[model samples]
Target: MNTENRGAAQPPEPARGAGPGPAGAAPLVDPLAAVRAERDPAVDVYLTGTVFLDIIFTGLDSAPVRGTESWARGMGSSPGGVANMATALARLGLRTSLAAAFGDDHYGEYCWDALAQGEGIDLTPSRTVPGWHSPVTVSMAYEGERTMVSHGHEPPPGTAPPTPRCPPRTRAAVAALTPGEPAAWIAQAARLGTRIFADTGWDDTGRWDLAALPDLRYCEAFLPNAEEAMRYTGTDCPRAAAHALAERVPMAVVTLGADGAYAVDGGTGEAAEVPAIEVAALDPTGAGDVFVAGFVTGTLAGWPLADRLAFAGLTAALSVQEFGGSLSAPGWTEIAAWWRHVQRYDDQNPAALRRYAFLDGLLPGAGARSWPLRRAVPTIGFGRGT
Candidate 1:
């Protein structure tokens, strides 16, 4: 088995009674006591999947010619997959943790450092294998489109180690997986009594065994994009595909890029098409992952299916308006404000609204011509609008 250590250094403790203590008393306590006390029992949203370093190069008009190069307007490293989802959840004030594998290399260290600084993220379970290099994806974004080349190592053999000690308040977990690892992880997650949300990764190609579907039978929700749903169900129509999945799983959701998403309640035979949030596309890199994050967050917050889809769609729409994947994602407060202002506009005011509401009649409580209004908002250094 590949082995590598990529753990982040623990933060330094403050001096005794340096600030305020319980009742402002200079109470004596063990240094590790605070760390132990901070162990949140809240069911952490477990993001089990791949974490990659995204190297994005922008500023091309179309696909590059062989040996030809284009200047990159911007470039940076950001989290990918489960790491990105966990980051989004933490940003939304959910206590989250990541359970995944990274190579024992600088990239792995980078991932550890990046995630360690985020609020509500616990990264104790990330394993580093010695012979593997952390996955990396390099993409070029031009004219709002992107083409990418990725390299990911195979997972080491052996089951993941048991979870670290957690506070009793853990609430939910979302696990993203390729077909190779789905059955075992899904069964394990279901047995834990944790609300399990899952999405298909790139490995769910035609070769995947349909028998594995039974393993996911107990999942609270199963998410797959249009292409994945089509491949999995052997159908091009998303609604039909969703129905096929619902026949096996409890709930199935198929996200249609630019068209919105289709969800079905297996028990009630109820389905709804949540309209996509209209926004000018920049680079549609991590929009789907962001959508999953939004949906899971909404689920944990007890939101109805309609609102859940709305949150998911809105978050995805916003993600493409910027360059990086999770870097482009908006926080809960930002999304809430955007949704209230952009989606809830006055339908009667022709001059005030933007166009692109093709699903007005198709979705419930929707109006015609719902376009996003772009205003010059001040950007903080951290991608937040002030």
Candidate 2:
């Protein structure tokens, strides 16, 4: 798709509750009318915020001691956060675009190349900082766990570049923020008639004001990992944290590393518990980003909530099997096939399978649900059961 003409077509109108609308008639305009008035394009996904260059170093036995040097078996660079999600979505056959800032440095160029050439993601409105340092993360993987050390400051504000050539069927916008200008960016996307999905970065914890929650309340989904949820909602339990967040947002999902995830609609009491995909995790760097990509893609494709969770879980499981973030991300074809096979075999024990399916769907595909079946298909080579 052409990146130049995408978001440059027209200016967005004021959203319904921005201020007073049409006189005494309630002041607020009808949301449906506004949606219809906007040209609902075929843009599959708009990803904004948290674009970074991730340098992954794999196969470490322990943290680097003061003077000791560890053998670095593997190293590679890939897109991080929202950028990673955009690329994953594009690889899964979605029309995706990225809106973020990058420095004019070599690191920024590397990030741009990964998103553009490597994943075919469009970068229309992405800004380039003339003399700024682009964000970078150094991730170290040991056993199955990983730790990240980040560098660089947030990108400076500037007029967004023209939109690129994108698909016309615009569906959802995923915003990954590290506590910088999230409210304004989110509002802008919302004005364009796109649903918003939010993910908080580790650095955003104490940096941004929580009061911004009210402004972000209109978001369709709010995704935060277990620790971030606890920090944001002031709770220890993932479910409680999700509930706290849901009180302000429409929907909330808290990802619990190996435990899985829990989602709830603050508007309703409905909730779903998803389990983690069981895999011999090689690296956990971009697992959450992959999960967000899969979930958003499934949701935009009209998959049921259960199916969405399943897809997200499966994608994350596949991601851990490889070293770099995007390298291990599975395509839609792989995810669909795995889901179908798991469903077929799960039919054996009706009652037990139903509950297992519900829990497994939470983990990605049936990585955890297919544990016992692993012995049946040893060639697939998923690790021992969870």
Candidate 3:
């Protein structure tokens, strides 16, 4: 296992010489430009978690057979785990800072460079541990689902440079709440006036008690899937679950897979829902992370609850059409292209198009990159040069 430490220094300027680094990369148009404040937070979003090197195999007809050799038609690899959400936020033009550990091995070096240089994420708070091998997850995707097997051990105790006691003061932070294991930094960041948006993984313990998550009180919004919201709230319907959850947090967003998402604002008793966009899904790896990033962007820009839901759903829908987790995240260029493409379809429902008509004023001028921007190569190790 790798150990991580935080530093007070700011992110270094992007390196100059590189085949595809942050240097000279055109900045995406900021969706929040109109709301820019003279005293804006130094960072738009801040998050800390484990980073995993994800190896994904796609284009499989079904789950692997027990006694036979199975082959996948396609494969891709990239930084994953918390990196998924970090990359998603960065791609959407949010100033994202990530605090995590990286192994000293080749995989770790590749992952670090990919995030810091390629994605332009701030890593001053991150550290590298000597002799630690990067954790890895082998994922198989088929039928819009995925099965993953991961392996890694925690860093032995007494390692140099422990986790940071205080995180940077950012506009917002995303926390993954786990039962019985509270993150101390969540409360600290909250006290510093950072809006907290949180999500949860499946509770394998079968105990969905809301009491287990003591840090929920500090959060401004809580996003959980349909099943998770229903289980935690003991509600028969997802919309009801959202309402129940809203009583705990100011806002509750419930994601219903193909049906899209529903959200409720307890502060104002506002409710909104958006249908999912139809597209051929190549991989559903980082769609959830993308969804949260979109919502955060809209929220920080002061968008309405309904528009937030719609934008979140639209971003997730676009991510499923690609492969990998972090690399599959779409940028503003992709969003602009999709908006233009849909506008050409005159037969489409006017209401549906009007729902997203707001993008017309927010989108940047046409960029040089083509639609469906070509993503990074499936695997690392093409020599660090290019």
Find the candidate with the highest lDDT and give its number.
3
Q: Pick the candidate with the highest TM-score.
A: 3
lDDT by residue for model 2 over 1-386, one digit each (tens)? 11222222121222111111121211222112323435555456776666777788887888778888778776766667567676666655566767777667777766665556445566765766676777888889987778889887854444334333332236677765555444565666666667888787775456445564544664789889888888877787889999888887888888888888888877786788777767777678778888998788666666556667766877788777666665456553344445555567644556434543532432242122222221110011234693
Superposed by TM-score, candidate 3 places the C-alpha of residue 192 at a distance from the truth, in angstroms, of 1.4
Global lDDT of each candidate: 0.62, 0.63, 0.83
Backbone clash total, candidate 2: 23
Which scores greater on lDDT, model 1 or model 2?
A: 2
Candidate 3 structure, TM-score to reference: 0.93
Candidate order (lDDT): 3, 2, 1
Instruction: Score residue 171 of candidate 2 by CA lDDT.
Output: 68
The lowest-lDDT stretch of 10 consecutive residues in candidate 2 is 372-381
Q: Say which prediction, candidate 2 or candidate 3, comes out ahead on lDDT.
A: 3
- Candidate 3 lDDT at 39 equals 85
Worst 10-residue lDDT window for candidate 1 reads 15-24
Decoy 2 TM-score against native: 0.71
Q: Write the per-residue lDDT of candidate 3 for residues 32-123, one digit (tens) a residue.
A: 67776788776788888889999999999999989999899999899999999988887777778888778888888888888887877888
lDDT of 1 by residue, 80-198 (tens): 65666766665544556676776667777656665665333566666767667778888788876789899886665663333433312345667654564434655665666777777
Off by over 4 Å in 1: 1-41, 102-105, 128-132, 152-169, 180-183, 202-209, 340-386
